[model samples]
Target chain A: MTAQAVISASDLSLTFTTADGPVFALQDINLTVKDGDFVSLIGPSGCGKTTLLRVIADLERASAGTVSVNGMAPEQARKARAYGYVFQAPALYPWRTVEQNVGLPLEIMGTADAAARVKRNLDLVNLGGFEKKFPWQLSGGMQQRVSIARALAVEPKLLLMDEPFGALDEIVRDKLNQQLLELWAATKKTVVFVTHSIPEAVFLSTRIVVMSPRPGRIIDVIETNLPRDRTLDIRETGAFLKIAQRVREGLKAGHSYED
Target chain B: MPVTVVCLAILVAWYIAAVFMNTVVAEAKIEAAGGGLVNTLDISWSLERPVIPAPHQVVVEVWKTVFTVAPWKVKSLVFHVWVTLSSTLLGFALGTLLGIGLAVAIVHSKLLNKSLMPWIIASQTIPILAIAPMVIVVLGSVGLTGIFPKSIISMYLCFFPVTIGMVKGLTSPDPMQLDLMRTYNASGPQVLWKLRFPAAMPFLFTSLKIAIAIALTGAIVGELPTGAQAGIGSRMLAGSYYGQTIQIWAALVAASAVAASLVYGVGGIERVVNARMGVRA
Candidate 1:
């Protein structure tokens, strides 16, 4: 509460006009994520969790209401390079090496001393020596890590991730989750993560926003009291279990309104 | 090694076809000259002139024209080749630039995509050879002669494949990848150069290989009706006028070699570029 809000959305809504009809993708979304907070948007498919994240990234337009990122409109914040976005897929250019892919934003933005920045970010993701390899040559999890490294290379204050680890196997996802927590702790960048996994939201977020499908709206917001210095082992703790239970209950309660 | 075998087999088949085709002309010559009707075996394998020259005779002519004559002289096959190659190269450069420019425009604007693409495609359906003579005449009236008219025809032929292929290439990036670029707040030109253009490379190169050969065909067609003093097309015309089958066959061989070399050169450059860019394919 002492920190200023980095992202604030109030009465935000988006409608997509398709051949069938106007689909209300997002409605009356009100949320506030403060500086250095890890907020996860957890919901089922077509729940508009990704859509909400996109509105913050300015990848999608909001039909109504006001939303701001780092005290500026999403579009303005985007133009100012205040945020880095990691897509669901790795989305690495096959033509570029790992280092080059990481350096893409810097190259586009005309940032100086890119080599040092790229090296540091690649190291942060524990992808230090794989700089010379192409995306296709690496495993899927490694490719996603490179994509994360790319996003972090810009040194943006806010990071927006859209199901970054959804495609990876369980073992790799667990390892990456641990690594991501460490990265977030070290950088202290405000993050808005979208995921369908309850455990993932519980394990990572400072606060979890549970959403419902069909004319998507936020159903509940749960704040975790887990320690900031927690590791993967903390998932077994009573405090972590309590938050997970709350998230599961919220999800179950969301289903009662499905019909 | 497999390529070598294929080439040898083609040569063997060509020699046999040449003998079969030339037998009719040889027998006709014997009959017209008041000699008794000649047997196929009795007809000479080598002749001063025949409907189809024997493979060895054409080879001899190629060797004589290429090596025996001074290359700088207009009579040499190399001189004609250089003339045709110059126009082909010039036209290819112009066409490639025009195609890329049009493709960029088409991909960016919905209006252009709908209006320009179909018309560009329809233009190809009206054959290049059919248009070459009219193009030559029109340009001649304006005092544009020799290589200029030929290169124009070459440009016409070269532009189509590049335009179509490049359009496909520029739009090849998946929606997710495109969204990533949008997230960066990249400008239109920035997205083009950094993302679309590089992604379009494999497609562009593949199209360029096809365009180069078509450009050569256009150059040859341009020279065909004009009866230019230089170029392989003129050489073929001269050979046809004098019933010199050997000379025509030699010129055809020269043109094929030029087309093959141009395509091979582009492929070589593609390999080097792809390797540098870390594209395994």
Candidate 2:
């Protein structure tokens, strides 16, 4: 009767011990992501949004409380290859061609049908005939797309993206945002995206988790009531503006606007 | 074009230096022969035994010894070059493999990193020239003559740079890249083969260039003090004993040529590897 929880966290905390002091990178984080749900962790810089994503991916350890991915411990889920993560940068190996870059995980895992999977994923990202081109030959946006293709090739159950389009120009960001929405709609894969842009969070996410810095905790969670097949045109609509305004208010309440 | 100009400038300077050095000897000989009229350049450049032979004299000597004799004959510079080259190649191959192996071990094991790196640095400070003869004599007493003993000395001199370079290379991948491999549940060897080794290619090639040059130096030095019957080192030694400055200079030129060719050969291999790995030019 209830949707299965793809990711669940309760009172999660992470402290990075630095030379100055113990930096509270994340604290008192509680959230639940359901199957097929698109959640955006929205925040300004130092908001622990990326830290939370890293915690779920088991790349960072929580100093307190517990988190489960697919009802298993984060480490266990990671060892099971339960998720695919797209970092802020493309992180494509410069020495590998586009096709080889996408196929890296498949080769490492020794999966059969690797060539077919690489082709299918590249096509899924609409990168069809640039297989032999090196990453350096592509533009930054294109390189990021290849990174996305790399993640999708693994066919992981969950997707974790950290500011995947943070460095792109506005026009390219808009285009990628639209392509990503369409991708989400087609695959129905659960995504937890981290971003600083309010409109981007509103445009792509079914739910937005607004966050603040000092101790790096959530400030608000706004559920966007928009059409499932949304378009960039929705950013001009009253419904989209209403959600965006609320996200702005939540961010303001956390004082993210101050220099 | 600039390189050619600099090289020509250096050759002119060398010629001037040889003339200045041999002028006193040439003047004294002319005076002893009752002050006969002879060109100063000819007398200095064509001396029976000058301090530093003119570049042309060294070239002429090399041409005569290399082109005018059977390559297998001891009198041929080609024979001496072959004797030195065999040891250099053998030492370089062994040194490279040993360096890479040590680097991998030091990288994967903290104990080795702590215990081995300082010693490797210390090993280089002992002066290869001091150790070369000791190594040759020790190995020779155990009847390990020929190329193997010389190669061991070459290996000793060359492995330091390669080990240091490869250690840096293997660890060059940033933390984020390493984490990506971890998320895939990739095995250790998979991470190393797919990520670390490929990542270390540029460093490996750089180290190989330096190691090849050092390996040749090591081979030549190993030939010294042992009075080895062949090789460029022995040729130079015999030339010095007989006060044949032209012969010594010719052997020195041949040694430099060998070093340059070896470095360029490594560079050629580097280019092919970079192309195969899709590195942008």
Candidate 3:
């Protein structure tokens, strides 16, 4: 069966006015994310990958072009509470315990049985037994996991993550990437991830969207032909290396094209 | 710990010196020949009546004034304490309301922040003592009596710290946390109640403790003029007029204890609220 498009962006552009002049953060960005698809946006610094993610999440507005999520405008989708977003840092409320932080969105959405939902989400993120712990008491990776648990507690149809594991060490990043994939597989939720690491993008994504800076725009979209059942062993396979190499070449091309 | 111990040691020494000074003054008075003749040779730092009375003398006078004296009597310590406490509590409540209201307004409005911030800061520069008597006279002529004048004085002293603390707390959210909330399409009010208010709590508690102390000072200052019927300040004025040094010292001690207790109460409440929020630290 053909996959249904969950998010569609057409000719999206975002510009911000600064003291220097008007700067284009993203330009002519077009992409479609299929339901249950794992897509990664990768680029160099100032390439507007995070900006594109923010626009799609409706945290930031686009200067031009139209974007739709779940057949609704980004703002409408956001109001409907159809997306879960994880930021670069954990962003957990320092004052709240892990359970309460996780339960925050549910509380805001006015969902009943918040406690049960919080417990379930904590379990999903493998943060069980840490419900009473405060954010500052947790390690960096644990804090990020708490944030993920918070987002998932609301059970949004789409998950948007902006460099969620970028602050973690390689060991933790690898582990979290695998866990994220496992989470996606189990929940069958569409994911739009942003990262600067080529290996991370190739390892986690079903499709990689490479972008260029200095007026950010998409340069290429490369699909992974690897099998759906992936594990730590998959990263060492020739197929994975080939896809990672292709992503690197696309990034190099992106750099030269911008120049 | 060492600093506190040193402070206590110094207070004990001061108390002993006050008692010795009183004895020396009394002995010199007995040695004088004429009924009103001054003893010039016994000039060993002994005044006819010491400005700072002995601690035990103050305690005995306080006990007599509080228990033996009638409410209508001019020397009743209990009456004075009641007056002061009433004014302090009223002023504290008003100041708390004003501070919280201003903080909320400043946090929510960019235009108000730009315009009113400088004015709020400027208001504190005018000393509260200078403003107190004027406030009393103006309010008195307008037929406002009792608590209103005193409460205004307390409010003047109490609001500044609270506003500063609350403003800082409200704006303390991290960039990532803010973006996360925005992505959820959280409304302004939702963000405030769920995020800013909780974050501002520790700061609010800190400000409240400070405000309470200022409120006590305001109440004492408010009593200094217009001959307050009851209050520690009024007691101090009466003591000065009659050379009743012990009465004044007792009132001062009472005020200090009350202030300390009020601050301690707020601290207790802070701990409970923080625990409920899972912010035990």
Model 2 chain B weakest lDDT span, ten residues long: B30-39
- Candidate 3: lDDT of A44? 96
Q: Assess the local accuracy of residue A148 in candidate 2 as a C-alpha lDDT between 0 and 100.
A: 94
C-alpha positional error of residue A55 in candidate 3 after TM-score superposition, expressed in Å: 0.7
lDDT string for model 1 (B1-281, tens) is 99999989988887677667776667676565565434443454578787777777888999998999999898799999999999999989989998999999999999999999889989899977789999999999999887888999999998999999999999999998898888888889989988999999999999999999999999999999877899999999999999888899999999999999999999999999999888867
Evaluation by DockQ, superior candidate among 2 and 3 = 2
- Residue pairs with clashing backbones, model 3: none
Of 1 and 3, the candidate ranking higher by DockQ: 1
Chain B TM-score, candidates in order:
0.93, 0.96, 0.86
RMSD of 2: 1.6
Candidate 3 C-alpha lDDT tens digits along B110-182: 9999998999999989987788899999999999999789989999899888999999988987777777777
Question: For candidate 3, what is the DockQ?
Answer: 0.69
lDDT of 1 by residue, A1-259 (tens): 5999999999999999999999999999999999999999998888899999989988888999999998999999998989999999999999999999999999988889999999999999998999899888999999999999999988998999999999999899999998999999999999999999988999999999999877889999998867888788888988888888988888787765635
Cα shift from native, residue A70, model 2 (Å): 1.1
lDDT of each residue in A23-120, candidate 2, tens digit only: 89899999999998899999878889999999999999999989999999999999988999999999888889999999999898788999999999
**lDDT (Cα) of model 2:** 0.92
Select the stronger candidate by TM-score from 2 and 3. Answer: 2
TM-score of 3: 0.91
- Please rank every candidate by TM-score, starting with the best: 2, 1, 3
